[model samples]
Target: MRNEIALTLQKALRELYNIDWQIDTSIIQRTKKEFEGDFTLVVFPFVKQARQSPDMVAQSLGDYFQQNLHCRFNIVKGFLNLTFPCQVWINFLKNNYTNTSFGYFATGNSDVTLIEFSSPNTNKPLHLGHIRNNLLGDSVSRILAACGKKVIKVNLVNDRGIHICKSMLAWQKFGNGETPESTQMKGDHLVGKYYVEFDKHYKAEVAQLEAGGMDKTVAEKQAPLMLEAQEMLRKWENNDPEIRQLWNQMNEWVYQGFAQTYQQLGIAFDKVYYESQTYLLGKQLVEEGLQKGAFYRRDDQSVWADLREEGLDEKLLLRSDGTSVYMTQDLGTAQLRYDEFHPKEMIYVVGNEQNYHFDVLKLVIGKKLKKEYGPRIHHLSYGMVELPFGKMKSREGTVVDADDLMEEMIIEAQNKTSELGKTDFEDGKASQLFEMIGLGALKYFILKVDPKKNMLFDPEESIDFNGNTAPFIQYTHARIKSLLRKAADHQINYNHQSFNEIDLQKAELDLVKMLYEFPQIVKTAGEMKSPALIANYAFDLAKEFNRFYQETPIFKETNEQLRDLRLHISQFTALVIKNAMTLLGIHVPEKM
Candidate 1:
């Protein structure tokens, strides 16, 4: 519709003023709430050329648009406000009410987008921080796909690192041959417990050494546990049989735990890359960098990339012992993805702390390796997720485990649902509804905040059924569903052409406009790469529907056509709410 306005202005300007005013469509904006128009156009730009006052110019342009487009107009200073006739809006509702894929689009060309997220380390279970990454990545992927992009979601597990060895070494010394089956602990959680134990004992050793008058820094390095962990890392790298077996065993346990969590979150990876498989390719890329003089090696034979020109500290690509760092595996994994997918863009949904790391990566890949895909690498750096109490530390076992958090959300959802006396479903159905509401609340709260801003996750605030929460929107949807069911029970079929000519109230018009904006909302959200836009849009639309519900009568109306029009609008609003929530990886229940 905005395009129609812009293109109409293009023809009007050319014919009226002999001015090829190349249709600056961006200037055409929604009119202010105080105004009487649907859209406003600035007329000051044509004033001098037309040899008229700003008011006269606006009046003339308004007349030209009203004549050409059949929309009524009012002029405010140099702004031309145009409102289309009721038929235009009613026709819009009639044409689109039944189309479920109303907002989906077909693009000019197919573009492949590869998104990498949830790069969990084997040393710990996924925490609240990982939840944000997973939600952001999954939601963005959904949004992009809706916007007509071919998206492949992937995960890179940091399966082999010294941090991992810390857990391995701790399990060897203090685990007493513990297994997940015997202990009834999820594999990942079990390994994470040992990781915390390693830190506790490692800190104790450092403190004990410092008690002997050794310097803190020196004691930290020379602690017996630290030394042993480093040795275990080396042995694992060298593929010692016992070390490899232990590494594989523990990682398998973690994988099982991770799978369960991913299922709970409804997240799946199109492909999973492990550092153990891709580090050699990273080593190959480093060698290529060295050959091209993109990096330098010290006398200790460790590879480094000098980025002082860019005001960044020098980055180590390889250690003195020829071991690879995170960058090494990342380089290899990125290249491997490019080779396989040839994506137009490769996005890494990592935390903001790795901003510089990705910057350096792009610099090396583009400036040094000079690879074509270097320019394709993108880092979707997002802020951390902190709780009301403060930040969490994975090493200290202070981070909120994703599994436990979801469980807590489900329990809270049950309590909240029961309080509302909405527990009338069969036992199994009631349980399922609790999980849906619980997870929906969690996902909506996290995704509602802009991805670039750190968010405080308050479980209590998220599970509420009022004010910008998922349950509110979900309940609104369920309300509509119940209304439609009741309409059926009364033997009132709403499908008919009579409602198309039915006069619409102001609230109904507002809902019609909101429904029409769905496509544009989706397109804009995709362009901005923000799901918060969609989340909030869904909330606002739900609120509008509720307002319309309260102000307008449906079944009780004396006019059959008017009541059917209201029901049609209500049904369409519910569909939009469900679609929008689905894009955020949330489910809207039929009952709440």
Candidate 2:
């Protein structure tokens, strides 16, 4: 409808002033609620082109729309407000109200988009921060796929690093042959326990060295525990048989634990890449850089990329002992991904702390090494997820465990739902409901915030069945489902009914208009790479439907046509809510 109006205005300009104008759809926007129209056109840009005052241009355009398109318009200053007739909205609803996949684009686009997220280190289990990364990456992948882009979700495990060595050393020294089966703990958590133990003992060693008059920095480097961990890392890199076995065993434990948590959160990856496997690729890149004069060898025989000319400091690619750094593995991983998928875009969903790291990655790959696909690298850098008290540290064991948090969310959901007297669920159904509400609350709370901003997650607040939380939206869906069931019980057949003759109430029209915006919202969210857009759009649509439900009668209406139209509207709204939440990697329960 907005497109038709824009085209009509363009024709008006050509007819009246003999001026050919290109109409941009962006100029036409939904009119603000305070305004009296459905759509608003900013005529200021056209004012100069038409050689008239802003108000005159708006009035002329409004008159043209009112005449040609049968749209009623009210000119407010320089804005042309156009309101379409009821039949226009009816036709739109008749066409799209029954579409099960209303807002989703058909798939099969060849533009591959590879998203790398949930880059967990084997030294610790997934934490609150990993939750945000996984949810963001997963949701964005779903959104892009909905927008007709072929998306490949990938995970890169930091399995070979100093951090992993710390955990391995701690386990070897203190584990005393204890295993996940022996201790009955999750594998990642068990390994994380040892990682913290290593930190505790390492701190003591550092303190002892400092007491002997060594500087704090020197004491830290000279700590026996630190030296042992470094040696373990070297041994592992050298493929020492015992170290290799230990490394593989511990990484497998972490992977198993990670799989359980990912299942709980409903996250899956199309491909999993490990640093141990990809780091060699990074070494090859460094060697190539050396041959191309893009990298220099330091006196200590370490390979370095001098990016100071590109506004970055020299980055260490290989250590003096010929060990690969994180950047080295990342370079290899990037090339491996591009060569495998040929993705048009490669997004790294990492924290904002690594902003400079990704910057260096792009610069080194694009400018220094001059790779053609280097410019496709995008760092979806997001802010940290801090607790109310402060930030978390993995080595210090201060991070919120992902498994523990998920269990808490489920328990909270159970308590809240029980309090609401919704305990009539059948056998095993209540547990399923709890999982849905719990996971829904977590995903919505995290995804509703812009990805670029840091968020403080309050579990109790997110589980509430009010405000912008997912429970509220889920309950709204449940309510609509109940209504549909009630209609079925009453033998109301709304399937083939004609809605053109019925006049839509204000609330009903508002909801239909909101529904009309879903495709656009999905498109905007995809382009911006932000799930917050879809999250808030679902909220608004639900809120509007609730208002419509309260003011407009569905089952109570005496006119059969009016009742049928209301029921159709409710059904369509429910489909949209379900679809939108699905894109956010959240499930909405039919009964919540």
Could you give candidate 2's per-residue lDDT for residues 259-358 as a string of tens digits? 9999999989999988778878888998999999999999999989998888779889999989788899889989999999999999999999999999
Listed per candidate, the RMSD to the true structure in angstroms reads: 2.1, 1.7
**Pairs with backbone N, CA or C atoms under 3 Å apart (clashes), candidate 1:** none
- lDDT per model, in order? 0.88, 0.89
1-592 per-residue lDDT for model 1 (tens digits): 8889999988887777777787665788878767888888988888778788889877777888888899999988888899998778878877888888888777557899999999899998998899999999999999988999999999989899888999999999999999999999999999998999999999999999999999999999999999998899788877899999999999999999999999999999999988888887899999998998999999999999998897888999999989788788778888899999999999899999999999999988887788998889989989988777778877655678799889988998999888877758976898888899889888998899999999876644544556898989999999999999999999999877665466677788888888888888898888778899999999999999999889887878998888888888988898899889989999998877
In model 2, where is the ten-residue run with the lowest total lDDT? 457-466
For TM-score, the strongest prediction is 2
Structural RMSD, model 1: 2.1
Candidate 2 lDDT (Cα, 0 to 1): 0.89
- Give the Å shift of residue 357 in candidate 2: 1.0
